[model samples]
Target chain A: MSEDEIEAAAGASVDPDARHAEKMRKKKAVRDKILATKTVEKGLIIVHTGKGKGKSTAAFGMVFRSLGYGLPVAVIQFVKGAWETGERFALERFGDLVSINAMGEGFTWETQDRQRDIAAARRAFETAKDLIRAGEHHLVLLDELNIVLRYDYLPLQEVLNFLTTEKPPHVHVVITGRNAPDGLIEIADLVTEMEMIKHPFRSGVKAQKGIEF
Target chain B: MSEDEIEAAAGASVDPDARHAEKMRKKKAVRDKILATKTVEKGLIIVHTGKGKGKSTAAFGMVFRSLGYGLPVAVIQFVKGAWETGERFALERFGDLVSINAMGEGFTWETQDRQRDIAAARRAFETAKDLIRAGEHHLVLLDELNIVLRYDYLPLQEVLNFLTTEKPPHVHVVITGRNAPDGLIEIADLVTEMEMIKHPFRSGVKAQKGIEF
Candidate 1:
């Protein structure tokens, strides 16, 4: 039956299966139209940044989702390597499909050494560039790379040059952290800014193990 | 040796293990302090809202993370029930640990009837309240509940009242959608507004199966 006709029929019936079937039939048409229009397929440079939480969490989520598709994914941590995270622990079960390298000394304030921080950032950036150029991994997550860029620990232009020029055409890269550089935003295929409307931390709630980390 | 002494010793070392150990020692102190002061462990009302794309994705990530900790999680999808989603497909392997119920007929635009939309929203909300009150699940994700609240299909005040008063104190609830009501925001323990800086959809890229769904 036509989707419209089925939907009209569904309006009178109380059966959920009939209603759901009709709804799906109609949705399929709209979704098919969208699918037809979107023909371009290329590796995306996705950036997650802003004042709210979930930037890194969302990036990790994407990594988890990509793994479901059997994609080889690498995570290179920039500023959160110092602390053990639940994601690192959870992702360990994936075996060889995921390669996580926690390279950062710590956050800038936590490290409290400009020269040392710069050296760490440079090493992390080099590792990131290698991962991107290797092309073995379909997705490479540069977790907290934005923090290094925001703090000028790594040269913005140099980072931009590598992203724009050296990144493999087929490698999907995700850069996550607050205060993303403008240059990176301009070139990114997708940029999500997590705005902080309310945080439990402000109300004296500490970060929980599975929820925050 | 004290954590301070170990950190001092590691300052001059090139060994990564030494540095990481030292950093962890210092971080442990700070984290311990935060943990010591945070004794309250109640159910959290988390709202992920805004124009960005990761609201539901992040919530799903939380579900994924929660599952890693062996917590029972349920996802009540309000407006996305008609189509199959990657998360729904992937989460199926967890067996009964994850309960994903896509209850809505469809989005308001697709459903195109106020009475039908209201009925659907009411049914979904009842299911959500049942899940929340049952307390079988550690986390209950009310996906796209904000859309129902936004369109006034469900009264905002009653939703707020239920969330605040009727919800089990230990059941963490996550609501995801755009235009979260201010009352909901005020009552939420954590609120993240996903701001869309740039989207590939705007650039004519189709939503890929694994990435968008």
Candidate 2:
């Protein structure tokens, strides 16, 4: 419709409010149409990767949301060592509903042992495979699994095969880390790259407890 | 140092493992020095903005993390209406420790009432100001307040002034949404832009319960 016709259809006046309302009415109609077309539902392969922070934090948020529904969740930390973190302590309050396994010795640089890192990654992957195969949990978070894959600690093809073929249809898998592989991204239903605009660390701010951890 | 000298310092032999360990040690020393210099401790202004998902999800993760620390948190959602969400249900389990106020009627497109939208924004901001002023909560999340500011429903200068000058020193404030104001970004200690690489919505997947909500 022409501008004048659209305005008249919204209202018989030149009021801006009426024009905006009419514009929104058209937009909502389009949105509702799109919403109607989206009908597929199943567990998703979600990937969070980039240099910026919050990759794992967002995944943890999903875990928390899932817990609200009394759903079981398994968190497998592949890079961070077994250490006390605020999220870990908080999630532990849910008891058996939450399972967190910090499998890595530490960062690769900290360990500086390729063989040892590979061993740790393999062990973590084994635990993850068991959890996914059992299909007891609603969500399984593979925290930092991409880092291990990037370093070639675990075979990428093998991991992808299991996820695509063996993962239960009802289980949602969230994989988080920097530098997620192309294959993983291609298979992931949703992928978000947290781009760092500004970080406090660059301003000499240390990672604060309850914030960074 | 020369390449040969650097290699000799790491290890006399040309073993990759030894060289890697030595390189890590040097890196550790530098990292330690930087950590030592970052002795400042104070609450931060965190901003998560971009077109991708997980902006509020990350903030809610922080809330969950804070709850783990037994910290009080207040969540003020400015754009989303008071609706049943998994995260809201999850947080309500924390009882008095969590206070959520879903003040917006809905998105501006849905409401199509600028005056009413402004009123809602004002009321929400008033509640936010009160929570921040009380200084009782460890973290206060202004979820989607950026959208209000972006639409000019609330005075950006007034909000920035309060955040900069009147906000309690001990309370961390997290503001999330797309198109965050430049002034807010200038004052924020940490800012992350969630860049969308792939979204399932484009692939005809509906927003699933316990995942999108």
Candidate 3:
């Protein structure tokens, strides 16, 4: 080992790291001062993209957190019909605090009805609009909604309007799908790209109870 | 201003007023890290107590935010049973994300059946247990669920068990009520006691739509 390398590896070059830490601390101090007085505007839009597991799962966690705060929550599932086992049983717990609307179709394959899919997604949106317009709901989850928009099942501009302009203040919105549109990402405050790390299905492990659903 | 006051303002003040901005920045950093790492658990359980209006409403906001994330979210309402018009249509949007088990009996005033109230609240918890146990849900808002536990309708230990053991690594469980049990607060990662600031009903203002829902 050369003397220069040993010195570089030792405390001789610690000044940069120490300076970086000091800068971070100062930055944090300034931020803490700002937060003490300001009321955080409680609204956000999350877009999930890239092929991965737990996109919907991530959003559901937020729903649980939001309700814990006593805020009104709404959810809309766009594609893939059928009353999910989890949603059916879970929504029953918070009767008034929660709102659920499914397209009421099993899926594109079972129903084999693109028209029906469009109709159901629209109806679900219509119901969702009332909550958004009413301005009572604190969070609204649109599950698989991106797929509907991507497929042209719903008008592009209308949904965009709701997300960008029509939704109420402090009313958070989440739109989840595999391939989110560029427009949605442009407007969204937060975008999560769920890169597929490893999926159970690919491993031949079927979606398990309490883990997948 | 005196010289000391000026100096205090800059160097020695408690600076609560300045903290909001700082907190917001820190929170954003924390939020971003959570978003980036996909490890910042998104959900929270806040017990809003101390005779406040909108305890449940606060929880609803987080629920809405969760939905906005396109997440699967569920709500378990312990009391306030009238199948709300808002909920009737709104829940359809959330689909599997918003799970609500309302007391269905409205308030204690209208309900003469002691057995019914207890049974209804118990039913909500039954579903909440599974939802919490499921482990992948991002957010599970137990709206006013503390009422059931406070009144001894649901077993506190079971609820705690889920919070400690069955809780998903990422899921956020929120409970709202008055006089949260010691055990819950003991186990809670974060607790917010909502003190009554001002209430509309007390001041002769009726609950308004969008604001009070």
Candidate 4:
């Protein structure tokens, strides 16, 4: 639409401020009704998975979000290796509240050896289980754990068992990676699948430091 | 698998460290080849939208990520209203490098009137356009502009025009909200649709301060 047309269409609304106020009042009434019905508070099992990017990034954001609430968080990286990451640098400043462990040598393709990859994944899982069992961390982020699970490095049954039985009631756990198993999805309270509609990386653009890492 | 079975499975690979080293060498060769092919650098218009949550949260994470690179950022909230947000509080600590303008009175439901909502959105758009035109911010986050656009509070054509013609060459702009327009998606370099597989709100949980806001 042209600028004039757009302006005219916008102005067609009679007394927008008053209309908006009334609309809000009605909305709040509905929202209050919904809010009133919700009384349960408990930890959440959030899984971020799919072909798209931002799974790990979003999980990292949650870590920061938890930190904002003064909640202690443990991040166990299963496949990213020892690369210098901006998140580690940015979040580590919180000191004792955040613990970051980069466990896997790298991606499965990068590591190549099935045996070595499995070993690394096992060690990472050990750390993840410990973190959950400790009851100290309010949020535990298992970054790229799905990749390990996808490759059968870590058994899905064990992962499910740990989350259901061993995890503290008030601890939120976020498992992130592509190709989340159906079983994991069934158990998760919150699951977000990031659909990649478009990606610059496919167009031959290299990942940037701050944006990608 | 049982713990013993898992251990045995993990230990099946012989000389894993050496195998891993060889595998990484081959992988790096391929990665280096791919990295060498990528030589272009330009601004990106990214969009985060869909029925799921994390749209706004991911945008906030980007703001923090940009700060890690010491990049100046502009965040203009179109529909989040004046509520105190952890991100606004956290990012504002950076002082002049970050500019956060929450222009809307609140959500459309809360504000009620279509006219008032349109006016608020128009004002926000003006600020967004100016921020883009100034070329000072390396990253600009148009949070919840999608919701306003979905409601026809702002002209989509003009928003698309400004992004395509006026945005700086190196500035990265992230537009986030649900129901992103087709035109916006078409032009965006990266578009991630946060598909809601499961939601906690379905289980009768209220939005928490640090996690949701």
Estimate TM-scores for all models.
0.80, 0.93, 0.46, 0.86
Candidate closest to the true structure, highest DockQ: 2
Judged by lDDT, which candidate is best? 2
Candidate 2 residue lDDT tens string, A25-91 = 7888898899999999989999999988789888988898888888899999998742257788778
- RMSD to the true structure for each prediction, in A, is 8.5, 2.8, 23.2, 7.1
Q: Could you give the candidate ranking by lDDT, starting with the highest?
A: 2, 4, 1, 3
lDDT per residue for candidate 3 within B84-166, as digits (tens), equals: 43443445556776666654454443454446767887777778888887865667777776766765666788788878876
State the TM-score for model 3: 0.46
What's candidate 1's i-RMS value? 5.4
Error of 2 at B66 (Å): 0.7
What is the C-alpha RMSD, rounded to one decimal, of candidate 3?
A: 23.2
**Residue B5 CA error for candidate 1 (Å)?**
31
DockQ of each: 0.25, 0.67, 0.02, 0.39
Across B40-144, the per-residue lDDT of candidate 4 in tens digits comes to: 677789999998877877776777777756778898999865234556656755678789888987777865667777889999999999998899988899989
Task: Name model 3 segments beyond 4 Å from true.
Answer: A1-42, A81-83, B1-213
Please say which candidate is ahead in DockQ: 1 or 4. 4
Candidate 4 lDDT tens digits, A1-213: 987688668754346566566566877998889889887777889999988867877777677777766778898989874234667666755688889888888777775677878899999999989888998988898988888898888889999998999888888899998999999999999999999999987788777766776
The worst-scoring run of ten residues by lDDT in candidate 3 chain B lies at B197-206
Report lDDT (Cα) of residue A54, candidate 3: 44
Q: Compare candidates 2 and 3 on DockQ and give the better one.
A: 2
lDDT of residue A32 for candidate 2:
87
Cα lDDT of model 3 by residue, A1-213, tens digit = 888789777745446444444454566677556545544444656575556444565566456555545567888777653226554455555678888776546444344455666788788788778877887778888888877777577887888887778877667787777788888877776565554422323223333233344
